[model samples]
Target: MAIEEKRAWIMAVVTIVAYGTYLALVLNAAAGAPLGEAPYVYAMLWTIGGAIVAAILLNILAAIVSPRDGGKKDQRDKEINRLGEHIGQSFVILGAVLALLFAITGLAAFWIANVIYLAFVLSSILGSIAKIVAYRRGFQSW
Candidate 1:
């Protein structure tokens, strides 16, 4: 497989695992399970940490395996990352709008806000995964 393909697989796997953990935590919380602090707070921390660790470990492993594939992202890789960030920003905008509308209409509860934030978080994870997939599938900077 190409270097980009390997990177994409790694990113996709990590994102899937992280998202699955988030879903599991949310479901457990809804079932009255204690999060040891607060539901949203601990969940947020867990999700963020998982993403960070996943990226670090996977990147390190890939670098070790393919020393020729330096971690320096090329132009194509950079563009893929930019596209991912664009998608993430779009999600952020959606989340913000939902938050604003909820506040203005007095319809958004704390839990609702939390869910909306998580929605953005999930979207970001998926966006990264999508970008990686594109890179692997040879959809270069376009």
Candidate 2:
């Protein structure tokens, strides 16, 4: 497979794993675990940190695999990332808006809220994975 393809797979895998972790955290928090934050806050932060760390580690390892060649991302790579970010942002906003709406109603159970929050995070993760796939499939350029 091509380098970009490999990168996409790596990203998708990490995203899936991160989302899975988030789901587990949400479940644990919902069980009243005194986790640091009410129910989803700490879990959300953990998910963010995990994603950041995984992405950073992947980049670092990719560089170590070929330091000279990995030093810079070409225009195509940059564009793909930009587009992916755009998608991810949409997911975040959608999640927040949904949460706000639910909050206004004041009817959602704690478990429901946690699940909604997790759904939003998963949306972003899936968005990123979709973008990578689109880039690889030639649906997205650069």
Candidate lDDT values, in order: 0.68, 0.66
Worst-scoring 10-residue span by lDDT in model 2: 1-10
Candidate 2 ranges with C-alpha deviation above 4 Å: 1-8, 25-44, 107-120, 139-142
* Model 1 agreement with the true structure over 87-113: per-residue lDDT tens digits: 767777777777778778776365555
Residue 80 deviation, candidate 2, in Å? Answer: 1.8
For all predictions, the C-alpha RMSD in Å is: 3.9, 4.5
> Hey, what RMSD does candidate 1 come out at?
3.9
lDDT of 2 by residue, 1-142 (tens): 3345456566667768877897786767657655434466666677768887987788677767875565666677777777777776776776667777777787445544664656556665666686667665776462
The top-ranked prediction according to TM-score is 1
**TM-score of structure candidate 2:** 0.65
Query: Worst lDDT window (10 residues) for model 1?
Result: 32-41
Question: Measured by C-alpha RMSD in angstroms, how accurate is candidate 2?
Answer: 4.5
